[model samples]
Target: MTRSISLIPSGFPFLDKKWGGIYRGGSYLVIGPRKSGRTLLALQFASECAKSSEVCLYFTNMRPKDLMIQAASLNFDIQSYMNHNLLVVVRIASPSEIYDVPNPDDYLAEYLHDIVAVVNQYKPNRIVFDELTPYIGFRNIDYLNDVFLKTLEEVEDKNINSFFIIGEPATQKAQLIVDTLRHSVTGSILLKKKAEQLAGQFYGGTVIISPNVGHTEGQFTADYIIEPYKGISVEPTIMKTFTRNDSESEERLPELSKIFKPITKIKHENIDDMQMNFSNIYSIEDFHLIINNQIALFKSTGQEFHLVSLKLDSSAILKGLITLNQLKNSVGKSVQKKDKICIVENTILVLIAKTNAHLLNEIIKKIRINLPSRDEVYVKAVTEFIKIYTLEISNSFNNSAELIELILSEEATNAHLTLSELT
Candidate 1:
């Protein structure tokens, strides 16, 4: 009888077929930008390998509990593997020490010793080392070169398939390490965030594979999406070119609608993804339409609606998003079920229905006090960073567009208004 294919599935059909499955003694490097689903893809691969193999080992600086939480966020059942003895997770002391020892003098020896110890103990068929950047911290580039080659040899000697997850290179040294590691490894998978005018972004990315690995040759790239619910789904077509080309090049290409297939967009329904603390917020256009409907309803029912406009800085959007995500639960508790919250670029909008203007005033005041400020140590607290504007939707407007225009005009006016003036 013929032996079955020994390739292990990555749970991504196109990826599996392209590579002919991950084989034993193969080493791979998975590289991507921050928050670009690098960890998700690595864990997804590990989860699939564990299901079919005797053991798969995962090494990370994250605590086992935190790791599990992260896996759960991606809808992965990592705990099941842990329970079944099919997966072994080891947490290093700190990210910097992944390839460093307690003493800088003995760093390389200790680093290799730690890796050898884990591999010997687990004897795992598959192994994953997540995030190789911190380990490269302040270390001699040549020493790191030796460590990479040695680690590959050690894993290959044991005939174990291994994956090393590395963040996108931020410095010249990092790029060197990445290039060296990619060349040494049996294969390399590159993940990058792509915001295509054609493809709506919910972590849509491109994957490129190196030559002479998993039946793939001469380099190949495919577009894929790592969705919250669906996990990773590679698009039907191989990406011949990047969607984010220069304006000159973009202008020369065929019309986007004609050249590109419509990628599946993420629809965030009201209160989508119960597992997350934050709800599925709307965009400015969607928020405007809803406000228009609310105005008509207010005219017919004679009910009042309140709109709270919170302004933020474009430079601090990422920081603001993180702060808002952390405080979403607190904000949700303060608002009613009928209230709607949406972020429009640098502004956060909270629309409350069937509430008295006076009560909303009080709520707004409380929000001013409770909301976090970008500055903390100054003599006078600077809540001036976030400008808030409260508006009562008027029913006298002829149409939703008119009402929306008025609201937008007022929003612009409020940008110049100070918190002191409001108080």
Candidate 2:
């Protein structure tokens, strides 16, 4: 009987698959902006490997301790792999601590020496160097390339697989990493923070891996939020498609969403995730702002508003933040008092909370009669929008409050609408 082994992706659609085939055995690198989530991404890949084999050497210089802590917190079962004699971890404070970068031959010799020693001693299937970039400095790109090419020559079919991480991309190294992966291993992945976007607010993004890892045929993205449903997880971004060589019945890619979170928490404290808290508001502005933010956050997390509620504080028409004429502009001319309504879409989205929702019935009674046809149409549309989305007008903060609280920060972050996005 002949034995056939096929590469099977974990089918974690919420991750990026830069390398089409898993890093079977060879040196690799991941480069991007600082705190761009390169380490976490590397850990995720390691965790995937830990599931199958033994001995995954995780060597690091910068944040080795923290990386282990984070992996442990995520409940990484490293000990099992350790017991299986499948993993080994080595840390180098800096390349100089281990080898001389000035001498290309020495650097390659050291890299090959240390890795082969670990593989020989432990017989691990994988070896990870988290801070490979520092070992090969900025002054010499060719030195890094030599280390990579020589390291690739060292990997064999029955030998250890490899992975590494780099930080703060420069055009040179980024290209080098890509070139090495193209010729050396199954693939490579890039982890980085997308630049912040200015839309009347300061925002920071979530971690992401390009599905198009090293020019391989795959793509994926995800956005995330701290929703009650998913504690502290990377939001699921949409994925394009996964490609494997022929004989692959189905292709699966890993991906995560890109999200822009608020810089401050001061304003976010007031916002909660329940539908009832904002159920009494009648202000179209607040409604638009809240709803819009929720949608964006959801998109960032790559999720839908499974539960939502919105209300208006029409007290403005009575107290005059908006006059009857302005109301007409919103609703329309054919509407009559107590009988008019309107619903405008493609605008802001906010979860409206008010001191009193019962009062709205009375306020609404007045519009039903005098509302013009246009105003009535808009009001009805808005009502229907709420209804269509399964949004409820809750009387209390009973169920689904945490889910609403989950999205509060996202809404408040961009609470004030930017004219650019609105236009």
- TM-scores for all predictions: 0.54, 0.44
lDDT for position 327 in model 2? 34
Q: Count the backbone clashes (under 3 Å) in each candidate.
A: 0, 73
Q: Could you give candidate 2's per-residue lDDT for residues 210-268 as a string of tens digits?
A: 33223345433344322211122454343234354435453222222121110111010
lDDT of 2: 0.41
lDDT of 1 by residue, 324-420 (tens): 3423433455576578877654556788888886777666555555433321211012244446676677756655566445545755655545443
Candidate 1: where is the Cα deviation over 4 Å? 1-6, 63-66, 95-109, 195-201, 212-216, 241-423
The lDDT of each candidate is: 0.59, 0.41
Best candidate, lDDT: 1
Looking at model 1, report the run of 10 residues with the lowest lDDT sum: 253-262
lDDT of 1: 0.59
